[model samples]
Target: MSPSLTLENIWVAGERAPRLGPLSLTLPAGQRILLAGPNGAGKSTLLAVLSGDLEGSGGTLTWPPSSAWAQRRAVLTQRNTLDHPFTAEEVVCLAGVSGATARAVLEELGAGAWAQTPYTRLSGGLARLVHLARVLAHLDQLDPTAAWGFFDEPLAHLDWRYAGAALRALSRRAAAGYGVVVAAHELNLAVPWAEHVVLLCAGRLEAEGAVGAVLTPDRLAEHWGISGHVDRRDEGAVLILEGFTEAG
Candidate 1:
């Protein structure tokens, strides 16, 4: 299904070209999506295509089209920069689509205290929070009729507080009618909140859709080359990795 924003038949090559799928993706307005994949599986590449930074080999990526890139979409790549001297407030201001939105986002991120601090002085997690605020502020500023946003490893370097804050921010973005897509290596942090989950392996889109149906241990183990067990625990399920070394 072509999303209000979507990708069809996308092919790409980076340091290495992965054979991701003859993949079909869709992004309806106001959906919360989580993308999980092993290293080099083209997760970042897919995000680049979504944010218009990179082009795909085949298929179509379509959006409802809005005022501009800033108004329509925001991307927080895994390689986000923390090299600037800007204070936290300044950093937040950069991401806002509007002034009021920027202020509001800083409030949400509790970033006002660090507003005057240089970017270089902040911790890695704090830097990521600043970037997240930017995305949020911009989205809030525009409130585009049809908007989209992507977060690539927004949880990097985050402790529990920032992790919760960062994810809550992403959820707020999605709640406000933006198509929100987030990428992470840990399924545990993402599975409960994601409306849709996309799992990719070896450059191929292994599975994508409702978390309940798409994240079975059989499929996960097959794609990840590990052993694991998944069972109903409470409202969600529990994943126990067996002899498998890493947790997906």
Candidate 2:
């Protein structure tokens, strides 16, 4: 069966060099994937590829033929710019989700009350939430059943409420068999929710698989420059990264 996302012979490049490879991978419907990596590992670049924000340097990145989410794939980046300062409501409206749907999405993100508030005047956290709501509204408008969600540091500057709402929505999408992929530095928020984990280091795939299976102590220490233990506790694993240094 064809997956929702396919990266065939993928190669990405940065200012310094090209990340050359004929990499092949697939992310199926109903799968929530965590793109994990140390700094400069190209996590953001990969997310860009999936969302069609940037063209890949080499190889082919294909979307599912049946559930083509070219427009449904919602991506939330850390840096969101508005050419003209808009109100919270205005931002949501741009995504083609106005009226009750927009109101509800903003309410979930705890920004409903700020409907008329100038988006430029909001705090960083609040602004991020508004942007998130906008993305959700877009997905709801385009094709909910065929939507794919991609977030690159969407949690950046987001408060607890927005974070919770964002993750909850992603989970909801996953349950509905949408391909949800997140590239984030915040491990705790992602680890529990992700069905699969892909670890990248220096532009290479260090590991990829189930969350627990891919995040090992050796890999963490080697790639992240931190020592940690992966302990299976109940249903999840805890990683004590760089804790030894703190004690010392």
Candidate 3:
């Protein structure tokens, strides 16, 4: 079995309440996990902790050796600011990724045409794709075994087509034994491709399990304060949100 990243009693302090955790979970390689929750639900905080950008106040996070983890993991934040005049392809190659591999990743995500365009000249969505391609290209240079990628709101500015392409690329990485943890709000689009879901609410873990069990109507209403149902089809499960709850 591929190695698992384990967290035990993880906690992060905030000004008033905990920012996240006092939570625990095991993320195994080869699994795609969707981090689902409303705003201020700690999804971004959790990703930061897992990526080693933020330290937890308490508890242990265990993974492969530091050297291996540093080399094998990649992170894409919700917002990436690049003011320089670097071209899209240049931004991707900044990670020392080969020109061929960087262009290939951009092409895969429908951003090939903009490879030579200056980063500042691209739209928000296109720039987001370039950063994503950079992350994917960086991973491409690493060993896939036990590799992991954490993405925060990756679909933020993407159109349906590009969002689908990005999700597929992440899925491909998972299939190749890389663990993918995505912080997302687009349940309908994201849940279908993910193997597991971790639902958070107000900095606490509400539920964590397979998509079918954790994303039921009751749970949706409870955690997200919304009315929704999971429509399971041959393609995969789709989350249909009707409206907000009375408390929502």
Candidate 4:
């Protein structure tokens, strides 16, 4: 089995309250993990900690040594900014990938036509795709067996077709032994692609386990304050949300 990333009592402090943690979890290589929760659930904070962008107030995140870890992981945050006038392909090449490879990554995401387009000129969705391509391009140069990808709300600006394409690309990475972790709220879309699910509620670990085990209707109600059921189909299971739960 591939090695795993372990978090022990990880936490981050906030001005008024604990932003996240005291949460422990294991992220195994070659698995697709979905970090699901409502807004302000500390999903982005947790990803930042994993990506080494933010330090937790307490707890330890254990992975490979710093050197190897640096080379083996790629992160795509919810928001990206590039003030400089760089083309789409140039943005991807910033990840140390070859021009040809960068173009290929853009093409894979159906952004090939935008390769020479200025990043600042593209619409919100197009820019998001470009950033995602850059992240994936970085991972392409790593040892797949040792690689890890962390994404926060990657599906935000993508339409269904592109969203599916992006998920499929990430799934391919997992198949090649890259540990893929995505923080997202698109439960119906994300759940099918993930092998495991980690549900957070108000900065705490609400649940963590296999998708089938963690994403039940009752749990969704309790954690998401929603009314829903999991429809098990031959293809895969999907969350069917009916409405919000009435407040007590």
Candidate 5:
């Protein structure tokens, strides 16, 4: 089947070097792709380009033509910069088709208790969950054919409980045929859910393939300068970072 989204040698212009990419990847429905890398790996930049907030200076990006770009894709960025004093429910309602759906999504994400709280007043993790609810609401309101959700560092502020809840929700959405892409750092919990993994290093795509194939000890060392063993558990794999190695 043809991909829902495609990037061909895509990259953003930089003052001294390319900001991101030369990445060529395709996203099909019901797939979860993990964008894994340390700081300055250009994960956020790539998400911006894919979500149509930023333009790439080179190459091509193609998406489904049936819906508006913003309607077809929902983005939950790292920072919650909405200065408006809207309540979490109101934010989701704006993204969702109706108030009831907004409330339902909040409840589903275990954020119902804070649905009336002002987004700015909530704790970092609570705020992130609310934003995620908004993203889910937006996509849920869209035509169910194929929608994409891009999350940048979603688990950064979330504790394990919230993180697990969010991951489970994303997994359910993927199972229901939505494309879920996350730029994440909490790998042990996420690796099992990811069908594909893209490793980035210094704004370059180091590896892109099935998670089991690409998420290896050798690749981790090469890209992250970490020497560790990958202990595969029944559910997921744990990356034990033993020490730092020189970047090859």
Candidate 6:
């Protein structure tokens, strides 16, 4: 059976105020959830909590109890902090998966030649792809029914081509029954593949639901301080922001 992640009334307390939460959500394995909001909307904070990097006060977080989460859960942070001298392939294998698995994931993600590159010598975009490969390989090593992956600003440094490739890889992972949660600044890019959307404004959840329900122009204006429309394009529907609104 697929595992599920459940959060009840979760909130992160800052020194003087709440950094995030009072948010409740349940994500089952095999689902795709997108976290969307402007800067400082607590999208990163929520991802930290979900990834077990930060503890939230006043709420419950639960997942499968039998396995070590380090093996079942994977995370790709926005920044690539590895300045070590290891090769990119070594970095990926550090996720506890076999070296072969790591190599395959890197190749699949269009970073095939990156395997032998020194991690510290790679450009930001290439480094990000290497880390992306690590997380995917990590999750791929687990039972798909119990896998969970979280990505924060995954497309930050990626070029358009690699970003699109990353989306395809993520889609394949979710299709294979692994739960995936991604934080995206570009909501339009995520909307095409996201099964559900969670909107956070000023550390609060402004809206949460399936893509069509949560990604409306009205909600964008209210939560993101923008007047926009979901424009239907030849490829798919895209969120187009016409202008800024003072009424957020």
Candidate 1 lDDT by residue in tens digits, 1-248: 11366677777654555445567876676777888887878788788877878767667766535457766777787877568797777777776345455666766766667766788998877888888787767666655456677889888777767677677878877776777889987666677667778887777787777776787777766666667665556766555666663645
> lDDT per residue, candidate 3, 147-233, as tens digits?
788899888889999999999999888888877888998887898888898999889988888898889888888777889888888
The lDDT of each candidate is 0.72, 0.74, 0.87, 0.87, 0.80, 0.83
lDDT of 5 by residue, 164-243 (tens): 88888888777777778899988766776687788888788888877767778887777667887666678665567788
**TM of each candidate vs. truth:** 0.85, 0.87, 0.95, 0.94, 0.90, 0.91
Candidate 6 residue 173 Cα shift, in angstroms, is: 1.1
lDDT at 176, model 6: 89
Clashes of 4: 0
Backbone clash pairs for candidate 2 read 9-22
Estimate the Cα RMSD of every predicted model relative to the unseen true structure: 3.2, 3.1, 1.4, 1.7, 2.3, 2.1
* lDDT by residue for model 4 (1-248), tens: 24688999999999888999889999888888899988989999999898888889999888644676569789999988677779999999999988899999988888899999999999899899999999998887887767688999989978988899899888888888888899988887898888888998889998888887888888888777888887777888777889999741
Q: Compose the digit string of candidate 2's lDDT tens values, residues 1-248.
A: 11467789787766667653445777776777888887778787777777777677788777633445456577777687775678888888888765678788898776789988889998888888888888877766555456677778777777666787788877776776667778887776677767789888777777788878898766766666666766667866565555543221
lDDT tens digits, residues 81-130, model 6?
Answer: 67898899999999887778888888888898889989999998889999
Worst 10 residues of 3 by lDDT: 63-72
Off by more than 4 A, model 1:
1-3, 13-20, 64-67, 96-103, 110-112, 224-248
Worst 10 residues of 2 by lDDT: 239-248
Clashing residue pair totals per candidate (backbone < 3 A): 6, 1, 1, 0, 0, 0
lDDT, candidate 6, at 204 = 91
**lDDT score for residue 52 of model 4:** 82
lDDT preference between candidates 3 and 5, better one: 3
Best by TM-score: 3
Q: Count steric clashes of candidate 6.
A: 0
